[model samples]
Target: MKAWFKSGAPWVWLNGGAVALCMIMVVGLLGLIAVRGFGHFWPADLVQMSVLDRDGDRQEVLGELVRKEVIPARVARTNGYTVAEDVPLVTRYLIKQGNRDLGSDFQWYLDVGMGEWHYPENAIVVERREWGNFYGFPVALKEHGEVISRLGDEDFWPEVEARVERSVDLHNEIRRKEKVEIGSINHKLERLRLERRRLELQGVSPEEMAQAEEQFAVEREALNEEYRRIKAERDAIYEQIERDSFDVETVNGMEKTIHLHNIVRVTRSNHLGVFGKLAHYMDRFWEFLTEEPREANTEGGIFPAIFGTVTMVIVMSIMVTPLGVLAAIYLREYARQGTVLKLIRISVYNLAGVPSIVYGVFGLGFFVYFLGGSIDELFFPASLPAPTFGTPGLFWASLTLALLTLPVVIVSTEEGLARIPSTIRQGSLALGATKSETLWKVVVPLATPGMMTGLILAIARAAGEVAPLMLVGVVKLAPSLPIDGNYPYIHLDQKIMHLGFHIYDVGFQSPNVEAARPLVYATALTLVLLIIILNLTAIKIRNTLREKYRSASD
Candidate 1:
C-alpha cells in the first residue's frame, strides 16, 4: 500500500472513486426529481376509504393516495396518535383530496384509523381552473340550472366528458378573443396615443397636429367599435359555456354544484388501465410545457417562463460575445505587458469571484437607475412619468448578465490567444500580412472553439441565475412577452418571466405548497434540460471549429 501510494496509484484511485461517486449522486438526485415530478401527471387510482378517527367518529374519504410511509411508534405516539403496544412502527398515508374551495386538500391518516379501502369505479377526479382539484361521485347533469338527466354512479362519465370538452373549446375561443384580438387592438390604440404625444413634443405645426389628432380619433373610434363587437361575441360564448353544470357528492356526503365551464378535465382515475393512464400522462405533460400558468403558477404550463429564459440567454450571449472578445483581444494583443495590464487581469479574475447578488445590486443601481434613467430622460421625454426605459427590463437584465459572465469569456479568450504558436504570427508577418489582418484572420479563427467553450460556460451560469434577474427584469408573472407584434417587434423595455425565478416562486412563494411541489421539480428538470441543450449546441460548434483548424495549425 505504501509503495502504491508512492507510485501515485492511490491518488489515481481516489480521483476515479470521487468521479464515480459524483456521477452516482447526480443520477440519484435526477431520478428522485423525475419520479416525483413526472409521476404527478399519471392517473393514479382514486380510492374510497372509510376511516375511524381518534375520537371514534367514522367517515368516508375519497382521493388519490399520494404517499405512504412508516413512522416510528414513539414519534406517532408523540404526535397524539394511538399506537398498538406490540407494534414498533406505524404506517400512514398522505391522501391528495384536492378541493381547495371546499376545505383542506391534503390529509394524513394512520393505518390504524383506516378501515376498508378500495378503488371505486365511479369515483371521479376533476381538475379545475381555480380550485386545485375535485374528487367525488357524479350525481346529475344540469343545463342552465335545470336538471336534464340524473346519472347512476358509473353512467354519467361519458356525458360529463363530452360536455367538458365543449366547455373547454368555448373557453379557449373566449380567451383568444379577449387576449389576442382585443389585446392587439388595445396595444395599437395605446401606441397611437403615444405617437400623438410624441408628435406634439416634437413641436409639429398646428395643421399637422390637428391632422394627427383627427387620425388618432378615427383609429380610436374604429378600435372601440371592434372591441365592442368582440366583447358582445365573447359574452355570448360565456353564456353558452356556463349553460352546463354537474352535481357531485362529496366524500363527507355533501352535494356541490360545479359548472362545466369551471372544469378543465374530469378523469375516472379508478377505471383507467395502465395504457390509458400513460396516455393521460403524456397529454398532461404536453399541456404543462405549452400552456400558460394559472392559480398563482401552481397549475397549468410554463411556456412563458421557458420562452423568457431562452430569450434572455440569447440576448445575453449576443451582448457578451462581441464585448468580451474585443476586451480580450485588447488586453492580450494590444495592451503593453506592464503594471496596468497586470492590474486589469487581476480585476477580471476578482470580478468573477464576487458574490452574484452584489452584481445584482450594482446592476440595479447603475444599469436601471443611472443609465436607463438617463436614456429615458434624454430620448423618451414624451413618455415621461410612465418611465419607458427607466425600469428593470429585458435590456438591462441581459446587459447585467453579460457583465456578470464577461470575465469568463475574457479569461477563456485570452488563454486561447496565448496558446497559438508565436511562429504563426512571425510567418504571417513575413508573408506581408498586416498585424491586424493576421490577428483577425488566423489567430481568431483558430480560437473560435475556445470562444465557444467560454460561451457554453457563460450560458450555463447565466441561464440558471435568478438573483441578478430579480433585480433587473424577472418577475413572478409577466403580462406580456418581450417579443410581440408591437412596433419594433422586440420590446426590450418589457419585464420577463424566467425559469429560475419560476422555480423560486413556485417552490417558496406559492400559497399552496403541496400543489406547487411537483411543479418545482418539473420546472427544475426543464431548466437542467435547457442548459444541457444549449451547452451541447455550443460543444457541437466547437468540435466543428476544432476539426477545421486542426490541420491548419499543424
Candidate 2:
C-alpha cells in the first residue's frame, strides 16, 4: 500500500473513480428526465371507481392514475387525515381528473377512502383547447343542435370521429388564414404606417410626404379589404365547425355539451392496444415539438422556443467569433507586453467569473437602456413612444451573450497563437511574407480549431442560460416569431421564446403544477439535446480544421 501510494497509483485510481462517478450521475439524471418527460405522452388506462367522500357518502370517480406514494400514518394524521392507529403506513394516489373549466383537474385520495377500481372501456379522454382535459362517457352526438346519433348505436363513434376530423381541419384552415395571411398583411400595413411617420419626422418635402401618405393609404385599404375577405372565410368555417356537438356524462352524473370545435382529440385510453398506444404517443410527441403552446404553456409544442434558441445562438456566435478573434490577435501579436496588457488580460479573466445575473443587469442598463435608446433616438425617431429598439430584443440579447462569452474565445485564441513556435514565424518572415499575411494565413488557420473549441463552450453556456435571457429577449409567450414572411424577414427588435425560460416558466411560474411538471422535464431534456447538437457541430468543424492544419504544420 505504501509503495502504491508512492507510485501515485492510489491518486490515479481516485481520479478515475471520480470521473466514472460523474459520468454515472450525468447519465442517471438524463435517464430520469427522459423517462419522466417522454412518459407523459403515452396513453395510460383510465380508471372508474367508487370512493367514500369526506361526508361518508360514496361518489363515482373517473380519471387516470398518475402517481402513488406511501406515507406514515402519523404524517397523514398530522395533515388532518384520519388514520387507524394500527396502520403504520398509508398509501395515497394522485388522480388526473382534468376538467379545469369545471373544477380542479387533479385530486388526491387516500387508499382507505377508495373502493374497488376498474378500467372502463367506455370512458373517454377529451383533449381540449381551454381546459386541460375532460374525462367522461359519450352520451350522444349532435349536429346543428339536434341529436344525430345516440351512443348505443354502432355508427356513433364513426360519425363522431368524422365530424371531429372535419372540425380539426376547419380549425387549422381558420388558424392559417388568421395567423399567416392576415398577419402578413397587417405586418405590411404597420410597416407602411411606420414609413409614412418616418418621412414626416425626416422633414421631407411636402410633395414627397403626400406621395408617401397616398401610397400608405392605398396599401392600407388593400390590406383592410384582404382582412375582411379572410374574416368572412373564417366565419364560414367557424359556422361549420360549431354545427357539431357531443354530450358527455361526467363521473358526478352531470351531463355537458361540448362543441366539436373546442375539442382537439378524444382517446379511448383503456381500449387501446400496445401498437395503438405507441402511435398515439408518437403523434403527441410530434405535436409537442411542432405546435405552439397553449394553456399557459403547460400544453402544446415548443417549436417557437426551439427556433429562437437556435437563431440567438447562431447570431451570438457570428458576433463573438470575429470580435474575439480580432481582439485576441491585437493583444497577442501587436500590443506591447506591458502593465496595461496584463491588466486587460486580468479583467477578461475576472469578467468570466462574475455572476451571470450581473451580466443580465449590465445588458439591460447598457445595451437596452443606453445603446438601444441612443439608436432609437437617432435612427427610429418616428417610432417614438413605442421605443422600437429601446427595449429588450433578439439583437440586444445576442450581443449581450456575445459580450458574456468573449473572454473565453480570447483566452483560447491567445493560447493557440502562443503555441505556434517562434521558428514558424521566423521562417515565414524569412520567406519574405509580411507580418499581417503570416498572422492571418498561417497563425489564424492553426488557431481555428482552438477558436472553435471556445465557441463550443460558449454555445453550451449561452444555449442553457435563462437568467440573462429573461432580462434581455426571452418572454413567457411571444405573440409572433422574430423571423417571418415580412420584407426584412428577420426582426431583431422582437422578443423571442427560449427553452430555458420555457422550462423556468412551466416549472416554477405556472399555476397548474401537475400539468406543468412533465413539461418542465421535457423542455429541460430538449434544451440539453439542443446544446449537444450545437457543440457537436462545432466539434466537427474543429476536428476538420485541426486535421487540415496538422498536415500543414508537418
Candidate 3:
C-alpha cells in the first residue's frame, strides 16, 4: 500500500472515483428531469373525486393529479383544516382541476377529507389556445349554437373530431396570413417610409423625390389591396370556426359551450392502449416543439425560444471566431514578446473572470448606446428619435456574448499557434515562403483544431447565458422572429427569445407556478440537448481537421 501510494496509484484511483461519482450525479440529475418533464406530455387519465370545500361541504372535483405530499398534521390544522388529534401526518394533493372548467387553476386538498378517486372513462380533457385546459364530461356536439348530436350517437365523436380538425386547419391558415403575409406587407410599407426619409435626408431634388413617391404609392396601393384580401379571407375563416362548438358538463352539472376554434387538443386517455398513449405523447411533444407559446408562457410550445437561442449562438460564433483568431495570431505570432505583451495577455485572461452581468452592462452602455446611437444619428437619422439601432437587440446581444467569450478563444488559439513546432516554420521559410505566408498557410492550418476547440467552449457558454442576454436582447416574448421574409432578412435590430431566459421566465415569472414547473424542466433539457448538439458538431470538425493534418504530416 505504501509503494502504491508512492507510485501515485492511490491518487489515480481517487481521481477515477471522483470522476465516476460526478458522472453518476450528472446522470441522476438528468434522469430526474427527464422523468418529470417528458412525462408531462403523456396523457394523464382524468380523475374525479370529492373533497371537503372551504365551507365544510363536500364538492366534486375533476382533473389530473399534479402531485401529492405528506405534511405534519399541525400544518394542515393551522390552515383551518380539521384533523384527528391522534394523526401525526396528513397527505395533501395539488390537483390541477383546470381554470376554464373549475374557476380555479389548481387547488390543495387534504386526502383525509377526500372521497374515493375515480378514473372516469367518459371524462374529457381539453387543451385550448387560451385559458389553459378544461376538464369535464362531453355533453353534445353543436353547430351554430344548436345541438347537432348527443353522446352515444354513432356520429357524435367522429363529427366532433372532423369539425375540430377543420377548425385547426383554419386557425393555422389565419395565423400564417397574420404573422407572415400581412406582416410582410407591413414590413415593406415601413421600408418605403424609411427609404423616402433616407432620400429626403440626402436632400434629393423635388423631381427625384416625386418620382420615388409615385413608385412608392403604386407599391403601397398594391400591398394594401393584398392586405385587404387576406383580411377578408381570415374573417371568413373566423366565421367558419365559430360555427362549431361542443357542450361540456362539469362533474357538478355546470354546462359550458367550448368553441372548436379555441381548442388545440382533446384527449380521453382512460381508454388509450400502450400504442395510443405513445402516439398521444409524440403528438404533444411535437406540438411543444413547433407551436408558439401562449398564456404567459405557461402553455403551448417554445419554438421561438429554440429558434432565437440557436440564432443568437450562431451569430455570436460568427462574430467571435475571426476576431479571436486574428487577435491570437497577432499576439502569438507577430507582436513583440515583452512586458507590454505580457500585460495584454494578462488583461485578456483577467477579462474571462469578470462577472458576465458586467459585460451586459458594458454592452448596453457602449455597444447599444454609444456605438449604436452614433450609427442611428449618422445613417438612420431618418428614423431618429425612434432610435432604430439604438436599442438592445440581436446584434448587440451576439456582440456582447462574443466579447464575453473572446478570452477563451484567444487563449485556445494562442496555444494552438504555440504548439506548431518551430522546425516547421523554419522549413517553410527555407522553402522561400514569406513569414506571413508560412504563418497563415502552415501554422494557422495546423492550429485549426485548436481554434475549433475554443469555438465549442464559447458556444456552450454563450448559449446558456441568461443574465447578459436579459440586459442585451432577450425578452419573455418576441412579436416575431428576427429572421423573416422581410428585406435584410436577418433583423439584427429585433429582440429575440432564448431558452435560458425562457426557463427563467417560466420558472419564476409565470403566474401559474405548477404549470410552469414541468416546462422549466423540459426547456432545461432542450437547452442541454441543443448545447450537446452544437458541441458535437464542432468536435466533429475539429477531429476531421486534426486527422487530415496528422495524415499529411505522416
Candidate 4:
C-alpha cells in the first residue's frame, strides 16, 4: 500500500473518485429531469373517479371526480373530508372546502368504457382509452369502442358564436332606440322652425316677437333636455351590455354550464389513431415548457419564448465571439507580462466572478435606460418619453449575457493562441507571409479546437443562465412572438419566453405547484437536451479541427 501510494495510486484514486462523482451527478440530474419530463408527455387517459364526503349522519355524499387515466386512488383519512387515497384528486374542482381523510370516504375504480363513473360508496371504478385535447377541447375514445358524438364537446367557439349573435341583436335593438329618439328630436325641431317662419311672415309687433322668441327659446330648451336624456339612456344601455359581454361572473357561470356537457366520448379522430397520440404528446411537451394565459388555452402559443431564447443566444454569440478572439489575440501577441497587464487580467477574471444579478442591474441602468433611451430619443423623436429600447427586451438580455460570458471566451481563445508555437509564426513570416495572413491562416486554424471549446462552454453556461435574462427580457407570458408580422418584423423590445424561466415559473411560481412539478422537470430536460446537442456539435467541430491541424502542430 505504501509503495502504491508512493507510485501515485492514491492521487489516481482521488482523481478517479472525483471524476466518478461528477459523472454520477450529471447522469443523475439528466435521469431525474428526463423521467419527470417525459413522464409528463406520456399518453394518459381521462379517469373518472368518485369523490365522497361522509356527512355528519354517517351517510356519504358522492362527488364527481375527473383525473388522468389509470391514476391509483390510494386512500388516506384527513380532517373531516374523505378523499380518494391513491387517486390524484383535484381538490379545487371536486371539493369546495374541507380537511378530510381521502381513504375512508371515497373509493376508486378504473372504468374503460363509460365516460362517467358512479360509485355506490362501496366501490369506485376507473377506466381508460386514448384521450387528448383538440382545438382547445378535451376528447377521448374508449378501447374498441365505436365513435359516438357526445353533446357539449365543442370549442368555446359555440359559446362565443351564441354570445356574438346575441350581441348583434342587442346592438340592432339599441340602434333602433337611438333612431327613434333622433327622429323625435328632429320632428320637434322642425315644428318649431315652421312656427318661427309663420311668425316672421306675419310681421308681428316687437313685444309679440319677443314673446314668440321666448316661446321658441323654451321649446328649444325642452328639445335639448329631451335629446340629452335620450343620449344618456342609449349610452347606459350600451355600456351595460358591453360590460356584461366580458363579465367574469357571467363567463364563469356559462363555463360551468358548458362543463356539464363537457363530455369526452369515443370519437374517430381526423388523424390516424397513433397520430392522434403523437399530437397529444407534442401538446403536452409544449405545455411542459409553457402555460396558457387563458382558461381555454388557445389564445397563446410557444413561438415567442422559442424565438426569444434562440435570437438572444445567437445575438450574444455574434457580439462576444469576435471581441473575445480579438482581445485574446492582442494579449497573446502584443501585450507583455507586467504590472499593468497583470492588473488588467486580474480585473477581467474578477469581472467573471461578479454576481450575475449585478450585471442585470447594470444592464437595466446603462444599456436599457441610458444607451437605449438615448437611441430612442435620437431616432424615434415621435415616440418621445416612451422609449422602445428602454423597456426590458431581448436586445438588452442578449447584450447582458454577452458581457457576462465574455471572460470565458477570452480566456479560452488566449490559451489556444498560447498553445501555437512561435516557430509556426516565424516559419510563416519567413515564407514571405504578412503578419495578418500568418495569424489568420496558420495561428487561428491551429487554435480552432480551443476556440470551439470556449464556444461550447459559453453556450452551456448561457443556456443555463436565468437571473440576468429574467430582469432583461424574460416574461411569464408574452403576448407576441419576437418575430412577427409587424413593421420592422423583429421586435427586439418585446418580451420573450425562456425554457429556464418556464421551469421556474411552473415549479415555484405556479398556484398548483405540486401538479406542475412534473412539467417543470420535462422543461428542464428539454433545455438540457438542447445544451447537449450544442455541445456535441461543437465537439464534432473541435475533433475535426484537431485532426486537420495534427501535422501543423507536430
lDDT of 1 by residue, 1-554 (tens): 88877999888999999999999999999998898888878888988888766666888888988789998888877877777788899888988998788888898888887888888887888888988789998889999898777776454667778899999999999988877898898889888878988998899999999998898899999999999999999999999999999899897879999998889998988788889889999989999999999999999999999999999999999999999999999998999999999999999999999988888999999999999899998988778878887899999999999999999999999888988889999999999999999999898998888788889999999999999999998999998888876677899999999999999999999998988999999999899989999999989989989998887767
Q: Candidate 2 vs candidate 3: which has greater TM-score?
A: 3
Predicted candidate 2 versus true structure: per-residue lDDT over 89-143, tens digit per residue? 9898899988778888998888877889999899999999888799989999998
lDDT (C-alpha, whole model) for all candidates = 0.90, 0.90, 0.92, 0.61
Question: TM-scores across all candidates?
Answer: 0.95, 0.96, 0.98, 0.63
Per-prediction tally of clashes = 0, 0, 0, 29
Residue runs of model 1 more than 4 Å from their true location after superposition: 1-6, 72-89, 152-155, 551-554
lDDT tens digits, residue span 1-554, model 3 = 88878999888999999999999999999999999888899988888899996568899998888989999999988888888989999899988888554477888999887999989888888788888988888999888988999989999878887888898998999899999998998988988898998998899999999999999999999989999998999899889888989898888998888899999977888868899899999999998998899999999899999999999999999999999999999999889999999999999999999999999999999999999999999888989889878999999999999999999999999999989999999999999999999988888989999999999999999999999999989999999999988888889999999999999999999988988999999999999999999999999999999999888866
Per-candidate alpha-carbon RMSD to the true structure: 2.0, 1.6, 1.3, 15.8
lDDT measured at residue 319 in model 2 versus the true structure, 0 to 100: 98
> Which scores greater on TM-score, model 1 or model 4?
1
For lDDT, the strongest prediction is: 3
**lDDT value, residue 513 of candidate 3:** 92
Considering lDDT, which of the candidate structures 2 and 3 is the better prediction for this target? Answer: 3
Clashes in model 3: which pairs?
none
Where model 3 places Cα greater than 4 Å from the true spot, the runs are: 100-102
lDDT for position 90 in model 4: 31
Ranked by TM-score from best down, the candidates are 3, 2, 1, 4
How would you order the candidates by lDDT, starting with the best? 3, 2, 1, 4
